[model samples]
Target: MRFDDIDARMRVFETNHDHCVLPGLYIVARIDGRSFTRLTRERHPFEAPYDPRFRDLMLETVQHLMNCGFQAIYAYTQSDEISILFHPNESSFSRKERKFISILAGEASARFSLSLGDVAAFDARISLLPSQNLVIDYFRWRMEDASRNCLNGHCYWSLREEGISAGDATQQLKGMSNPQKHDLIFARGKNFNDLPSWQKRGSGVYWQEVSVSGVNPMTGQEKNTARRSLVTDIELPLGEPYEDLLASILLDGVANRSPILEDVK
Candidate 1:
């Protein structure tokens, strides 16, 4: 065998036996909302496949969590559900996982409601997992769900337009499995590259500020102020996958009050 393969096998073997170093708190957040589907259908009635706006909003929500003090916050979307990851040592928000989930859902719902002129709601569930394997399984389940939903029909159609078919896409995804589950989370280097350049650069989030001009909900009067805000671009550990970095930051935030660092050891 090649030296690299042998080394990789050795590392895997060591990781499999090491119990202490792998223990860290993991938060698996599932975000859901009916509004997303409704808005997607309404906005892209003829698209018959995907809505770029929906995807943009979801990414924005993920970015919001990352900026709000979550370390290693990585988000992946399938259907209307967004799976988010966080590392254990970071502590930028109190009730970190729950708060971010709630905030993300609320922001998505508000944006959709306001932009579409319809009522909407989003909800999320945060859970702690014991092992990285479980996290991997969770992502696999979501990916399978996305495939079953016709290759994330709402998201895949866009990929298909670019020549990626549903069946081939699903198989390609399955081939790129990761025990760490970080592979499953969306990253700027991977999935982000598939997006339009404007989105990759986060123009949609910024444009929301310029496009929205109306009465302020809280003030109940006409307002010229920008309502939408962009989350700061967080710097991640060098060479780390975006999802892993996001997870680290989020876990740090959650670990502030709870002593869960040992779990990731």
Candidate 2:
């Protein structure tokens, strides 16, 4: 057989199962750390529930993903998980689902492991949203989850500090209501409302234009210019305010495109 014929025959196996995301739909890639409980606890002993060092590592990893050639508009990270919103018109890898999943997972795993000086891994998946409303709802869901995680983590750790075993702590909070959890932490003298915003609502990263002042080398003249930069927001709003924030971000990417619900299925 000719070499060309042989090569074509072998390539079918790899390409046969490939699938691409349809255009015009929004893409959100969620990358989550694997076995992070073991990685952050037994193996590394990072501070329980939340740790600045661990959070910084996650933020650095998120920043890297946003700048690493993907058309990511906004990125969020909380508790070893990252969710990135890619521009709707982005055509990278021809919108191949497997390509995004493989490459993003690899990128996040490599960046985080190197930053932490340890071997860690992450998994990636893509969510194809049909409308702007769904996109907002998706982020809202994640933020709500962050709020729950914040309460549960504090309660569990507080119990542990009081000599409660891990199993017992988990059991005690398993059926507890959110109000009860808040009371538990309050009884320990920590108010849920006073916790760091980032801990409760997670953090967001997005691009913004900011003015920069510069000095010209040739004529010693000062000049001010605007540049696009990524801004990380640890203090994020909630409820309708957060929905509005997401709407504005979507507008920046999809201005004058079409009505948000026009293409809904």
- Model 2 root-mean-square deviation: 5.5
* Per-residue error (Å), model 1, residue 217: 42
lDDT of 1 at 209: 24
The 10-residue segment of model 1 with minimum total lDDT is: 200-209
Q: What is the lDDT of residue 177 in candidate 2?
A: 93
lDDT of 2 by residue, 37-103 (tens): 8999998999878898998899889888887887888888899899999889888888899999999
- Best candidate (score: TM-score): 2
Clashes of each: 31, 0
Candidates in order, TM-scores: namely 0.44, 0.94
Can you list the residue pairs that collide in candidate 2? Answer: none
Q: Model 2: what TM-score?
A: 0.94
Instruction: Write one digit per residue (lDDT tens) for candidate 1, span 22-67.
Output: 2366766676876555555665453545356555555555555444
Worst 10 residues of 2 by lDDT: 256-265
